[model samples]
Target: MTYTFTCKKVPLSDSVKEYAQKRIDKLGRYFQDDPAVHVSFSVEREVLCAVEITIRSGSTILRSQSQAVDGDMRGAIDSGVAYIERQILKNKTRLAKRLRSEGFPSVVEDVSFAVKEEAEFDIVRTKHVPVKPMTAEEAILQMNLIGHGFFIFRNASDNAVSIVYRRNNGGYGLILADDME
Candidate 1:
């Protein structure tokens, strides 16, 4: 996979970069095509290191981020990669369908799992609303006006369904649906 690294208020050494490349290269086995991997490293108060990794193939994206205490960059990187791996494992079937629909080769193989107890959430309520076409700004406005945490609508620009949500950090985030073949 191709890698692009960015450092925020932190300098990366050649050895660190090489280490990161080696670590991320191991993930290439999961993709038929080499995906673009973007990695960002940041330092917080000189005591913590944050690592963000994003893998992009066509319109699908898998991302993970982690912060390591005591400024351990390697640990942060490892944690981020593990998170992505877990995500892929959890959604392997869904990802395979998406890949095939998008004309991409499937990279996951079926594996038997040992039964284990897992937490479950009961559905308490369900509400359905007609998705209206609107710009992202309009969706954000509607979400704020309704005092709702998120609003769903069809994106005017792409004619695809989209979601606008209020972020915990006092900002809005947009999730656009990618057109698949």
Candidate 2:
């Protein structure tokens, strides 16, 4: 397994490394044989602290990133990890089917899904989305793996159509549909 840290504007400190270690350990089980961990820390305008964490396990890879507008690295890491956990729990079945890891949970419990009530307005609107269950993290990995600047996928989090693209800042950005009207 390899661990990599990238620092920009913000220096990687012992405390930050320690905190990152703690954070990644929370998702240790998800990692497979010889997993590679990459974390990027950056500061924008000397105010915002941004972090992007990428974990590669065998042929399966996922990336989760969080930014602290207040420039708190630790908080950003916590939020990023929480996002990953939620994604894992929500798509536990989907992920398990795709990724063969003993650390992955077998059952999908306490899952939440929205229920839309029928309306008798005689009008219904629908948009086509990729049925493949994938999160933003997977989208990014796929994008980079293919050497593409951007990639689009169905967001497993909210079932929203989303796009992940590379930014000029050496980081990635996600765009979600805001309005269909």
**How well does candidate 1 match the true structure in TM-score terms?**
0.69
* Cα lDDT of model 1 by residue, 1-181, tens digit: 8889999999989777788888888667667677999999999889889999999976678998899999789999888887876666665656655443343224434533322223354699999999998999999999989999999999887789899999864788998876575
The TM-score values for the models, in the order shown, are 0.69, 0.57
Q: What lDDT would each prediction earn against the true structure?
A: 0.80, 0.76
Q: How far off is residue 163 in model 1, in Å?
A: 2.8
Q: Which stretches of model 1 miss by more than 4 angstroms?
A: 96-126, 132-138, 154-161, 176-181
Misplaced by over 4 Å in model 2 are: 98-102, 105-181
Give residue 44's lDDT in candidate 2 (0 to 100).
84
Q: List the residue pairs that clash in candidate 1.
A: none
Candidate 1, poorest ten consecutive residues by summed lDDT: 111-120
Candidate 2 clashes between residue pairs 3 or more apart in a chain or in different chains: none
* lDDT tens per residue, model 2, 43-113: 98888888888877755567887889877899998887777777665556556665555776555456453
Total backbone collisions for each predicted model? 0, 0
